[model samples]
Target: MHILILGAAGMVGAKLLQRLARDGQLGGKTITKATLHDVVEPTAPEGCPFPVEAHASDFARPGEAERLIAGRPDVIFHLAAIVSGEAEADFEKGDRINLDGTRMLFDAIRRIEGYTPRVVFTSSIAVFGAPFPEAIGDEFFTTPLTSYGTQKAIGELLLADYTRRGFMDGVGIRLPTICVRPGRPNKAASGFFSNIIREPLNGQEAVLPVSEDVMHWHASPRSAVGFLIHAATIDGERIGPRRNLTMPGVAVTVAEQIEALRRVAGEGVVARIRREPDPTIQRIVAGWPRRFDAKRAEGLGFKAEAGFEEIIRIHIDDELGGRFVA
Candidate 1:
């Protein structure tokens, strides 16, 4: 099978690339070729059994999407987008990269004759607006308040419609806030969810821009990568016409998260988290969904960390070499 991965330089994209290189296959088939595309050139993985190509290209450009789709890869993992904060702050850039770019990809695929590849789209929980119940259900209506979420909602609709038309086999998974993201924080309004755990674990101070009682759905980097793989490989027919599904994740508050860090590392690590609320981030996060039922994802075989405690351990294992200064 030939595979194409867009946004291959980001955290999740890079991890997915590493996983693919390690296994050298996807969905029980040997990968014959892999193309990695990003706004900037992605690194080509070495020592792979199959040929690998990395390109610096923008899908939003007129002909770029068509060029990327020309070879008709067996599977296409679409993970490119402007994050919520940046998208909300810059409407034009968000629309160009997130909305128009996705449409271009779909249209490019439609232009392909007799090519129906499996597509795994990485969606976000921000698609659901505020006034949520204790848990957001699978049937919850999406009323996105943020531009990023709005773009993803539109993408989900397009994926379903395109799949029904037989242009592509598409699966959209709404991922939770990926906690303990292994890098410097990006411009995401939700970056604090990972920052609180990641920086402190590294013996660096992290600012908490929200209250301790603030709750949100979360998953580990490991679980995020797993969700993408499962969505790519699962039986599309079983997914039915819904096409898009919310992934399962742990529901925990900032207090519970810090407690978990304390348990895993020590009070010193947890103490590194400073409480200095940013009203803008607080307002944005307050408008986001804090929990999810995730029954459909559970039934569909998607999994996540059991709780905040387990999430912390997964981060240590995956990004910290299983050790941290207490």
Candidate 2:
């Protein structure tokens, strides 16, 4: 079966691509083709068994989404979006890419003849606004606090509606903040979450933008790829009309993260984190959901790291060559 990935160049998308290349199958079918797309050209997975195509294209532009969907891939993973901070900072750009682009993609699929592909959309926890429940539940209403969250929520709704109409088979999973992210931090206000753990382990000083008491949900990159795969292969009939799902993750505060880092890489690594407050980042992050029940995802067999320490270990194994500065 042919599979298409939008926003296939970002960190998560790249990881998912490598994973697909390694597995070489989805939904019990041997993957014969993989097409990668992004605003910036994506690099196709190397040594892939299937024919791989990487192209530079913006889905928000007219005809691009349709052109990508024209292949009628058996599965579509929509992982592209303007990140939280960028989306909040630039309203129009975020709306265009996150909302319009997604709608266009779904509409294009809906217009297709005798075609209904499994669509795995990468949503965000930001979909739940402030005044949140102690543990956000599967039935929690989406009241997004950020433009990025708003965009994701809208996309989720669209995915549900489109699926309800038999236009597509969709599953939208809201991912948590990925900790110990490899490489330099980007514009995401949540970047500090990974920076604090990632930089310290590399023996570099990382600024802690939020207070240690601040809590948030987290998952490792490896687990994130697993969630995508599970979403792509799971029985959509079991998902019913509520196509979006809040994925399970470890919930911890900045202090807990520090403790986990200390436990994994020692106090020497922990001390490398410098506390420098950024009100902009703090405010944006403050509005994010701190925890989630995610019972549905767990019931559906999706899993994540058991704890923050496990999340740290995953980063060391996957990105740090199982070693770090002592």
Local distance difference test, per candidate?
Answer: 0.90, 0.91
Give the 10-residue window scoring lowest on summed lDDT in candidate 1: 43-52
Q: What is the lDDT of residue 130 in candidate 2?
A: 89
Q: Model 2, range 169-255, lDDT digits (tens) per residue?
A: 999999988877899966567788999988888888999988999999999999999999999999988878888999999999999
- Once model 2 is optimally superposed onto the true structure by TM-score, how far is the C-alpha of residue 111 displaced, in angstroms? 0.5
What would the TM-scores of all predictions be? 0.97, 0.97
Q: Which stretches of candidate 2 lie over 4 Å from their true place?
A: none
Model 1 clashing residue pairs (backbone): none
Q: For candidate 1, lDDT tens digit of each residue in 1-326? A: 88999999988998888888889888889989998899888886667678888889778999998889778899999999988878988999999999999999998998887888999998888888888888899999999988999999999999999999999899999999888788897667888889888888888999999999999999988899999999989998889999999999999998998898888889899989999989998887787888899999999999998888999998899888998867
Q: Which RMSD values do the candidates have, in order?
A: 1.2, 1.2
